[model samples]
Target: MNIAVVTDSTASLPHELRTEHGIVVVPLHLVVDGQEQVEGDDVGTDWVVDALRRKVDISTSRPAPVSFLRAYEQAAKGGADAIISVHLSAAMSGTADSARSAALESPVPVHVVDSRTIGMAVGFAAVSASRDAAAGRDVDDVLERLERRLDASSVRLLVHSLERLRRGGRIGGAAALLGSALAVKPVLHVQDGQVEPLERVRTASKAIARLQALTVENHDNLPEWAGGVDIAVQHVDAGERAQGLARTLADALSTKVETTRLSATVASHVGLGTIGVAMVPRIAD
Candidate 1:
């Protein structure tokens, strides 16, 4: 049966990959200075970074259920028998809830997955699911592969400050880090779908180093069944540092690393100079 893969813009999947896999993307909303714009479309990472630097009021909202319903209908019209809609962490945003609500009214069978992670972590799962569907796998088989990919993926972040996250209410247990020393640089990770503080360092350099070490540790701990891994380096206005980290990881891991800027929606909450790494174990053929 022909199946389609749908994901939100916050997944940060490259446009080429989305086109190659025939994946449908529904954009989230970003409000800057009371002007609500669509993420990645009406607003971009650069614009968001500029707004943040200027201290413009910024906030994000999940796509309406109708937006997802329209996407589902279009996919069905495109000849899809079913669809697997993947989204960022429900704990972080209500996007998954919107997808689930739309699924109820979808013309075709819609299976919504809360990745429990964000950025390329969710992107990686959606890509894998699309491949499985393209290979003629049934819905159950496709979901099985998607789950395996999600289960083996990890995301780590190094943000300049916790202020943006705090303002957006996305900082879970990391809220305590705000009370610590002003010099403390936080290394955070997505745990059980919530942003949690992983380590505290006194310098940004030390925090970045710790972030790379944690990524390496996560890569080393993968099970033998995972044939290989895919790594994505994401940043917000920290291109130089992100490129350096990606190169270091590529050489150390003996694998290719992709570097991309975070989506406007994510960057708004993470703030500028935020660096993140997403590692996903490749499924063996």
Candidate 2:
């Protein structure tokens, strides 16, 4: 059976990977100072960082159902027997809902999976699905592999401030931390598809250190089925710091680490100087 894999820009999958795997990407929308632009296309992390630095109004919107319908139609036209659409967390964005709406009108069987996470965690899931589909695995097998990757993944972020997240309404339980004393750095994580506060520190240095320690701890605690772990360091306007963090992680974990810029949609919420790490277990082939 020929299956097609689809994902959103917020997945943070590199262009090469997406192209190599034939994964179709649906971009979300970024509203910049009242002007709307497509994420990853018309706007990217550089634009978002500049806008944030200038205090420009920035917000994100999910793609319309028609956008996803078009993607499904094109895939179907390319002779796909089925499609698996993986997307970012529903708690953070309505992209999944739009995909579902399009699936109802699709010509082929479209299975929309809410990754319940963002960044490389979702990217890894899409890659896994694409690989399984290319291997001629059944739809169920492909979905199973995708779910396994999601279940074995953990993401942590260190942001200079929580104001951006609060302003975007993406802060879940982390809202309480905003009331604390000033100059407090926050470390957040994705839990139950919502961004929640994990730790609060007085300095960015301390927060970065804590972020690394927590990642190491999480890596050590993974289940045996994980086989191995893949780590990706993500940042918004903090490339140097992200590279440093990735190098430290690579040395400590004895594995290669990939550093990628967060998509504009996510950066709009996280704001500048945001650094994150996403770790997913590599399931045995």
Candidate 3:
């Protein structure tokens, strides 16, 4: 059976990686100053990042059903007998729900899984699903393994500022209050797909160190994604810092990590200078 991979845009995957992997990305919407823009339509990460850098007002919305429907139809037309869709945590966004809704009427079977994490944590599972499906694994078996690996993955975020989060009311006023009084850096983690305040530090350096420590501890001194046992660093316009932190994780985990900046949709909420680490485990599909 031929299977295709589907994921929402919140994963922040690069253009070349998406193309090379033959993965279909369903984009979410972005609203800036009350203007509606669909992901990959009115704007992409680059344009959204530019708007964010200029301090334009911004917000996010669920992807229109049409986009998901269109993507699903395309995958079926491209000889996909079934689709294995891995997506960002349902807690953070309605994208997964949107995908599921549109998939009900698909010509081919679509199995949607809420990856329960974002960035490379989810990306790892998505790509792995793609690989396993291409290798002719049963859809149920592939989905089961992806679920297991996703459960074993861990995500860490070092947010430079909490103003955006506070303004959006995603967090309590405590973060904003502390920021106003004195700068406080917090290490954020995904606890059951919800952003939970893991630890609060005073500097970015300390936060990076903390994340590195977590990766080493959880990974047992090595990554488990079957993708070469590695860690990945994603930042928002924080390439230099991201590189430094990636080097730290690399040494601690004894593996190399990709050093790439995050998408604007992610950066807009986390704000610039945010650094994230994704640690995933291995399981046969």
Best lDDT among the predictions, by candidate number: 1
Give the per-residue lDDT digits (tens) of candidate 2, residues 56-124: 899889999999999999999999999999999999888999999999999999999999899989998
For candidate 3, the per-residue lDDT at 75 reads 96
Computed on alpha carbons, the lDDT of every model, listed in order, comes to 0.92, 0.90, 0.77
**Model 1 lDDT tens row, 148-205:** 8888788999998899999999999999888883778889999899999889888998
Ranking by lDDT: 1, 2, 3
Residue pairs in clash, model 1: none
Clashes of 1: 0
Q: What local lDDT score does residue 256 receive in model 3, on the 0 to 100 scale?
A: 68
List TM-scores for all candidates, in order: 0.98, 0.97, 0.90
Q: Which scores better on lDDT, 1 or 2?
A: 1
Query: Candidate 3: misplaced stretches above 4 Å?
Result: 172-181, 221-230
- Residue pairs with clashing backbones, model 2: none
Clash counts for the predictions, in order: 0, 0, 2
